[model samples]
Target: MIDEEYAKLLKQAELDYEDNKKFIMVLKKIRAKSLDREFNMLHDKAFEEIDCLKCGNCCRTVRPIYQQKDITKLAKRFHCRPIVWEKEYTDVDEDNDRIAKTVPCPFIAEDNYCIYYEDKPKFCRDYPYTDKTRLRNYLRETMENSKICPAVYLMINWLKESVNRGTLS
Candidate 1:
């Protein structure tokens, strides 16, 4: 069953997306320190309230873009050649960069847990992309992610509320 709060948050996020593009653009240009402070504050508050493990929607639906470093590390951990691992578990994306081919990543177990949780890529470890360096593009990408990941929807809702309340202003 869908959590009612999740549904409400998703609706609010959609509404905010339509109504607050300007706010988003303006926030994108705000100083990195200010944005980081606000993002960290909001992230802490939202994480305290939302349990991602309960949903695991992001894990089930989205694939992180794996860097060469990530591939090398994972390959070493699995005791396999990077080329072999890439062939079996991933594919070249449009940019001809190696990325996971399947959603719910091949390494994620049936119980919705990561088999390589500790060794997961930095992008996976920092899913939803909240860093100030790519905050704007991340937010834009998150709008698409929201359709599949409840956590992204929740984060976007929380961000919208923070902006509305002037906490991020």
Candidate 2:
């Protein structure tokens, strides 16, 4: 029961996989400050058209990394100790990072509303990390995320258009 837009996004992402990597390389050559400004602007523009509730692809596809404070916060919400919460809900990944045990995110409801949005992990809150500074540092992650996030896909495409049009260099 995926929305048509989401379906299209998935297909487009798959098809653009190679191009996205090249785009990331192109981004690497841009001045970091200029790239950050353009990405921040396009990130805002993409969100204005992309309603996340309609397409919780990232929540469905990626596990949020959990910090100790995140565990404590959600544990208090569930009236449990941080240790209990961590044991029940998280697992140490191969990289030794604590990540959510489930995909589709346990915090996300059927309607795609976050059950504990305010208390969600910083990683979840940050999501794609397109708006943050140090754009060059996040290029690899952002390139990967474009496939999963329509806003990112759109932002990347918009930036590509700008580049092709000579508006961005």
Candidate 3:
């Protein structure tokens, strides 16, 4: 089970950042300094404390924006034509990007396992995008995800503290 304290922290972080970008420049510098090792440490610690099976919030709330290749692959997995799959399962978002039809993600099993786990899209596989090498490049994306993923919430909290302490400089 995920400790509720972390969930509360996520909520607090959401509240703190929704209207502020005070940390954005520090975040960029941290990322630009190639502090992947520091981030990887924080990232690993967060995941050690949080379990995804207990909280598949990302799958529960976010839609995977589909690439053409993702569409084709999913169609193949379902043994249907890409056009047919596209018609039934996707819609164009306001940005004209193709996103999945379902909000909670149609592929999530009752137990929170992705039904299409093995054949899922790259976006799904890369959800939260924290462990990448140059994590600074994904600072905006990580900030957005911090609200939903406890691991991200914890990682960001640590990163902020580290930045202020000059330990990460």
Which structure is stronger by lDDT: 1 or 3?
Answer: 3
Question: Per-residue lDDT of 1-169 in model 1, one digit per residue for the tens?
Answer: 3356755666666666654445567667666677767666666666677666555666766777788888888999989998877777788878877778898677777666778988888878887655445465565665665655556666666667777787766
Model 3: residues >4 Å from true position, as ranges? 1-7, 18-20
Error of 3 at 31 (Å): 5.9
CA lDDT of every candidate? 0.68, 0.89, 0.79
**In model 1, how large is the Cα lDDT of residue 76?**
92
| TM-scores for the candidates | 0.76, 0.96, 0.85
Local accuracy of candidate 2 as per-residue lDDT tens digits, 10-90: 789879978888888788888888999999999999999888888888889999999988999999999999999999999
Lowest-sum lDDT 10-residue window in model 1: 130-139
Better of 2 and 3 by lDDT: 2
Winning model by TM-score: 2
Q: How accurate is candidate 1 locally (lDDT)?
A: 0.68
lDDT of 2 at 31: 85
- Least lDDT summed over 10 consecutive residues: which range in candidate 3? 1-10
